[model samples]
Target: MNELNGYDIEDLEVGMTASFSKTITEADIILFAGASGDNNAIHINEDFARTTPFGGRIAHGFLTASTISAAIANRLPGPGTIYIAQEMRFVGPVRPGDTVTARVTVKQLTRERSRAVLLTICSVGDKVVVEGEATVRTTSRARREATV
Candidate 1:
């Protein structure tokens, strides 16, 4: 399915789902640390990370969180999805070589507006790395049909 795009006030609905998955790699952690300037030992220094509570290198929280964007963009609400807000919590660490997956489900839609409430989660193996809720907007069918 195509990503959800610019929605209208009349298009929102509840119980929608979207998702995407990726394997975390050492390179990904390195690049994220360098780009985001979050050079925390746990994320970039293996030896230093070993001494930390997690006992190994872990990916940045935001890096794992960012996977939600890809999930919403590639699946459920495809091309034109508009992100309004996201509330996320990192429940566990994402180490290199772990495969992470994110899934978003629509929980509610405001009838007066084209906005939907989405519940989402990102997981690695059997552990949940991040979970959250997001508000998004998409164009209504009437708007698209008219344009077409």
Candidate 2:
């Protein structure tokens, strides 16, 4: 497994970006359904989903959104970053086998508060699957240890 290299709060700058990608799989959806208790037919029942507007079963929107969260937590300000708020819009459906890439870019930062605002987006190839903004409180190794 590969590990992400994260920056400290002080190192962040507007426009800095980080990303992570994964291929959506049947098992990924099934596990997300179970863990999130979002067993909607549109996500898990293929025969039923085929009758819907999307034409087939789609991955959970949150499951796709979580990819953005992963990128922020693991790649950007990284390990000590605490998510404070998020606003997301699901613009497209993610189906099994689709390769999704989650990307986050620094939009704003408050050095005094150790806070950052990031533009969050998830895409499958060239099509956007999800878009959002996320707010997080970042802590450095010293700050984290102090808090504990």
lDDT of 1 by residue, 1-148 (tens): 3234533445444665667888888889889988999988888888999999899989898999888888766664555777899999889988899888998887888654556778989998778889989887755666567798
Q: Which candidate number maximizes lDDT?
A: 2
Cα-based TM-score, every candidate: 0.85, 0.91
Q: How does each model score on lDDT?
A: 0.78, 0.89
Tell me the TM-score of model 1. Answer: 0.85
Model 1: residues with Cα > 4 Å off, grouped in runs? 1-13, 144-148
- After superposition, which runs of candidate 2 have C-alpha atoms over 4 Å from their true positions? 1-5, 141-148
Residue 78's lDDT within candidate 2 is 84
